[model samples]
Target: MTTTLEQTAMPEAEADQVRAVLEYYWAKEWTDGLPVVPVTEGYLAEFLAEVDRDPDEVLFSITHLNRHLTVRLAAINAAMAGCRPEYFPVVVAAWEAIAKEPHPARGIWQSTTGTAPFLVVNGPIRGEIGLNSQGNIFGSGFRANATIGRAIRLALINVFGLHPHKLDQATQGTPAKYSACIAENEEQSPWAPLHTEYGFEPTDSVVTAYVIRSVMHIEARHTMDPEQLALDFVDTIRRTGSLIHEYTSALLVLVPEHAEVFAAAGWSKEDLRDFVFEHATRPRSELVAVGKDALSHKTRWRLSSDHPDSMPDTAAASDDPDTVRVLSHRSSIQIMVAGANNAGVSAVVEVFTLNPPREFPFSYSRIERAGH
Candidate 1:
C-alpha cells in the first residue's frame, strides 16, 4: 500500500545512461508520448519532502486494476511530468478528489466516451503556485496548470496501466485528455468562488474534479444583454450530441465580461442556474426526431421511481410533449467565472455521467500544503 524511495543523494547519470533511461521508458510506453524528466532518486526525494504524509501511503486505489497509487508513485509521476516540488500537494489532492467519485473510478478513467478528469482549482493556492486563471487559461503558458494536469494523466497511465488502446479504451479522445486543469478567475468574478458554493471557506485551497467529455467554447460578443448571453449558453448545452443522457449536467465557465453582464443585470449565480434550467429545454418532438425519446422515457421512469418527490411536476403536467427540459434539476447547472475579460468568450464543459446519484459528476478535496 506504500512505496518508500531511497533518501540517499543520486549523482547525475552520464549522457549514455540518460539516453538509455529515456529509451527504456519509451520502449516500455511509460512516457505519455513525450519525453519525461527521467525521475531519479534525488529528484523523487525533493518531491517527497514537500508532503507531510508518508511516501508509501496509498492516496487511492483502483480495485479492478489491482492498482494502488501511493504518495511515492504520485511523486514519481509528478516529477516525470515536470512539476516542481511545491506542486506535489495539489497533485495529491487531485487524485484524492478523483478517488471520491461516485461512479466506479475505473469507469471514469476508462470509459469509451473518452472522458477526462477536468480539474478546477480555487483559493489562495492559485496565487501561491502561479496557476493561470486569466488569458489563455485553458491553452498554455503556465507550468502549474499544465503539469498538475499531466501528473494525473501520467499516474493513470504508468501506475494504473490505463494505457490507450489497451486498458483505457477511448474512442477519439479530445486534446484535453492530455491536460485539463485551470484555476477559477476568482479575483475578476463578481460572485463567490466555486469552492465556497460547496461550503468551503474562501481561504480553503481546494481542487474539484469532473469527468468531462468535451470543452466547448461559447462566443457571444455582440450583446450586452445577459438574457441574450444566456440563450447562447443554453443553445450549446442543449446540443444534440451533448444530450447523450437525460440527466446530463454542465459546468459553465464564464469569462469576466460575461460575469459582469450577469452581475450588472442583478443576477446571482443561482439566478443564472435557474434561467438555464428553465430555458435549456428541447421539445419532446426534437428528442423523437433525434432518437432520444426512448432515453427520455427511461429518464421519466427513473425520476418517478427513484426521485418521485423531486420530480418536475410542472413539465409532467403540460399537455404538450414539447416541454422536455435537458437538465434534470436546477442544481445541475454550475457556473464559475474564468478566462480573461478581454474577449466575449466562455466555455461550457459537458459532464460525462448522468445524475442518478445526483452527485455523479463532481468531487472535491482540500489541498494540504506541506509547511502550513
Candidate 2:
C-alpha cells in the first residue's frame, strides 16, 4: 500500500512558518527583535484618523537615518505600541524633544552608559488622559502610562534606528525601555504642573525628556524643617555617585508629601533651588573617577563664586593618588516636577543629560503644536 506522507499540523505549521519568517528576517538584520505588527496602510490609517494629522508633515527626524517621522509613521509606531489615538500628540512631542540636538539621542542610545529617556508630562491632558502619578505609578496597570511610554521607545527604536547590539550600545538597559511615562499628578501637586513650571500655559500639553540612570527616593520623614529637608538633599547629592558627562541633566521630582513639608515651611521654589545648590557640591577629585573627562578642564576642585576664575585644578594624568576629590562648580539643578498624591514623600532622580554650565535658555521642545 502507498504510504501517505505525514502532514504537518496546521497550527504547528503556522507557528513554524512565523518563526522561520522571523528568524530569516532577523538573521538578515531586518528586525528590532520585538515582533512589529505589520505597519500597513490599514493599521496606520486608523491611528491617523484619531490624530487627524497630515501624513506629509514632518514631526521629528532622528540622526543619520534621519528618520523624518511624519504623522503617518508616528501613527504606525503608536498603533504598534498600543497607544490611544489621543496619545499620538504626546508621543510626537516627546520624540521631537529627544531628537533636538542637545538631547544626545545619538550619544545616549549608543553609549555604553546605561541611560534611557523618561517622558515627563504636564498640562491639562495629564488629567484628561488618566496618566498615573500616585502610588505604584511606575508599576504596571495603567494604560495611559504604559502606552505613552511605549510610543516614545518605539519611536526611538524605529525612527532613530537604535536597534539593540547595533546602534544602541547600552551596557545593561533597564525594563524602563518598555515604557517610562509619568504624569505630574497635577491634581495632587501643590505647585504647577511640569509644563507650567517650564512656562507652558496650564491648558497646554508638554513633555520633557531626560536621560535617567535610576529613580532614587530621598526620604523626607527625617524631619519637616526645610533646611533639614535641604540637608537630606545634600546627603543624597554628595553621595549620588553621578559622574556622568558634564551636560547630563538630572530630574528632581518632588513627591507631594515632601512638597507639603517645604510648602508649610514657606519655602519658595528658588529657596529649594538655592538650598540644593549650596549643599550639593562635590570635590572634583571624587568626580574624575566617574565621568568622561569632557569638562575636567573647566571644573574646579571646589567651586566658589568668589573664586569663579580659578578652580582647584587637578591634572588629568596626575599621579597623585589623593587628588580625586577636587570640587567643581555645582552644576545647577534642573527641571523640577512634583508627583504623588499623599503629600508626604517626593523623589529626585539624577538625570544623565546635564553637565557643564549652559548659558542659553533651554526649551523642552518646540512647544507642542495643537495640530499635527
Candidate 3:
C-alpha cells in the first residue's frame, strides 16, 4: 500500500515511444475514450505489490464474454487509470464486491438502461487513500476517487469487452459511467456510516457496489422541515422517467445540512425510508399515461383490490389500482450522508432492478491492505 516504488525499474521512454503506447491502447480500445497512463511493467509491479492475493487469482469472470478479471489484469487497468499504488487495494475490493452481486452483473453493464457501477467506500480507507467525501464528491479533482472508479470502467471495457455499441447496448449512457466512486461523509453525517448498517464495524474499511441507472439531484434548500424534504425526495423517486420497474430501489445521498435537519426533527434513516415508501406513489393511471401500464403488471409487487395480499395492510390504504407505490419495501431505500455542508443539495440514484430480483442487490467487500 506504500507509494514508494523504489524496487521497480521505471525507465524513462522517448517521446515517440510514449505516443506509440497511447496510440496502441486507443487502437485496441483499452481506454475509456481518455488518454491512459501507459501500463508499464514497473507501474504494474507497483500496483500488484499492494495486493496480498495471487496475481493470477480470478476476482470475477463474465462467462459470456469469455473474460476473467485476474488480480494481474486489475493491477494493469489500475495503473492505466492513473491510480496510485496505495489505491490498488480499494480497486481490488470494489471488484470483489461486484463479484459477490447476486444478479448477473454482466447484464448491468450491457443493459439498455445505461446503468453504471456505483461504488461507495466507507471506514478508514477514505482518508487513508485521500478519497473525497466532501465538496464535489461526485465531480472531478480528487485523484483517488476518479482513478479508482475509472480503473473499474477500464476493466469493464478491456476485460469484459463492454464497448459502447457492441456488448454494451446502453441507448444513452450516463456521465457516471466515467467515474462514480465516493466516500461517506462520516464526520458530517447525522447517522451511522453506510457499511455499519450492513453489520460491518466502523473501524473496518469496506467497499459497497451497486448497479445504478441514473443520478437525480434533489434541491431542497428552501425547506428546513424533514417532512418537506421527504416530500421532495418522493417527488424525485416517483417521477415517470425514474421508475424503471414496479419494485424499484434508490440510494439517497443526503448532504450534511439536509441530514442534520432530519436528525433535529428526530427522524432516523428508517423513518425517512418509511415516509418515502408511503408517499412516493404515482397511481397506475399515470403509468398508463406514460405507456408503462403493460409493464407494471409484470412485477410481483403489483398491487390491486383483487390481490390484497400483495402488499401489507392492503385494506388500510387505498385499494384502487392507481395507488401504485414506487418502492417495493421500506428497506429498499438506502440513505447515506455525503457531500459538503455548503448546500441543501442531495441526490437520488436509481438502482437497477433485476428481473428475478437479486437476493442481495448491493454487495460489500472489506478492503484488505497488503500483508494483511
Candidate 4:
C-alpha cells in the first residue's frame, strides 16, 4: 500500500503573507502553541534536494498505528520549524532513531506524563551545524539547536497526529515539548564521545534520543575529589519525588569543570556510573510509606540479580523496608559531558518508566549525511 505523502495532495492553509501563514497554522492547532515558519512547495522542494531523498522514500513506520513518515513530509515539517535545508539531515537522523520500536517513542508521545525526546548530537556535524554544546546549551538562543529539535516535534504533530488533547494526552506538558537538543562537548569531555562509547567511529556523526520527563541541574563545587563529586550526584538522583523505586533511566550531563575532576583523577565514565549506582539509593521503607510496595520486592530482586555486589545491605531482612537501594542496575544510568567549561554546574535528565504494557528501551541512531 502507498504510505508516502507524495501519493496524496499536500495540506494547504490560505494566507497572503508570513504573518498570515503563522496565524493560519496557529488557528488550525497545527503548531506547538507557537508560530511556525510558512511552508511552500518551492521551499520544501529545495529542502528535499539537500538529501537527494525521494519525497516518497519512507524513513520509518509507527508500528502501533501503521503510519509512515515520508522524506517529503519530514522536510515540510523541517521547513515549518524554521530549519534550513542543511539541517535536514540531522532531523532525519533524529526521526530514524525514535521511529524504531526499540526506542518505543510512541508510548512517550501518548503518555499523560508528557515525555519529550531529548536529542544529543556528536561528531563533526555538531560543529558544522553549530549545535549548542556549551553555555546554556539547554536554553534558547541558538538557531540550529532550537530548530533542529523543533522540527522533530513538528513531525510528530503533523505526521503522527500527536495533537494536544487528541492523540497527545500529556496532563501537564513541559516547555521541553517545544524543543530540546544539545551536542556533546567532545573536546572537553574526559571520556570518549557518547557515540564512541556506543561503538561508533570518532569521526562519525550520531544522534542519541532519550525519552525524558524532567531535568535537574546541580552544582557540586564543594569538593574536587571524584568520589565526593559522585556523592553529590547520588544525593540528587535519590530525591524523594523522583520515584526512584520505579527506576527506568537517568542521564548525567556533566559540565566540563565537573568532568575534569574525574578525568584528573584518571576516573573513567564507568567509574562514575558504578559510583552513582552504588550510592544513589533511598530507603525501601520510604517507598512503602509512600504507597510504592509493588516496587519494593521486585526492585530489590532485580538489584541483587543485576549487581550482586551493590545489593542492599538489608536484603536478608526484606521486611526492613527502611533498607536503601532504589536504583537496581548500573545500565539504567547514562553519562555525557556538555555545558560551558569552568563551572561545577551540571544537569541530570531523567526518563521515567512507562506505565504497564508499553516499556520502550533507550536507543541511538547514527547521523549519516544524506549524500554520505
> lDDT of each model, Cα atoms only?
0.84, 0.62, 0.84, 0.78
Candidate 3, residues 1-372, lDDT tens digits: the string is: 666777666656776788898999899899999999987797788888898989999998887767899999999998999999999999999999999885544566887878888899999989988999999988999999999999999999988888999998999999888999999999999899999988999999999999888888998899988898899998988887765555678899999999999999999988998899899877676766765443423443334324434333231355565576666667778899999999999999888776445544688999998888
- Alpha-carbon deviation at 82 in model 1, angstroms: 0.6
lDDT for each residue of candidate 4 in 254-354, tens digit (9 for 90 to 100): 99999999989988999898889877766666645654434334333122223333333343346644555546568678898999996799998886654
**Cα deviation of 79, candidate 1, in Å:** 0.6
Residue 222 accuracy (lDDT) in model 2: 66
* Model 4, total clashes: 1
Off by over 4 Å in 1: 1-17, 104-106, 296-320, 355-357
* Model 2: lDDT to the true structure: 0.62
Per-residue lDDT for 9 in model 3?
A: 63
Q: TM-scores across all candidates?
A: 0.89, 0.75, 0.89, 0.84
Model 3 bad stretches (over 4 Å)? 1-13, 104-106, 296-320
lDDT of 1 by residue, 19-106 (tens): 8889998998888898888888998999998879898899889887788999999999999998999999999999899888855454
User: RMSDs, each prediction?
Assistant: 7.2, 8.3, 5.7, 8.7
Q: Is candidate 2 or candidate 4 better by lDDT?
A: 4
Candidates 2 and 4, the one with greater TM-score = 4
Q: CA lDDT of 269 in candidate 1?
A: 96
Candidate 2, residues 1-372, lDDT tens digits: the string is 655546434587877877786676556554345654445677676667665457878876655555677777677778767677777677777767765636463455666766677877777677777887776666788888888787767766776677788788888887777778887767755666666655578778787776667776776776878788877765665562554433323456777777767778887666776677655645444554443222333632223323435433343345753333211333346535455555456566666544343432133653343453
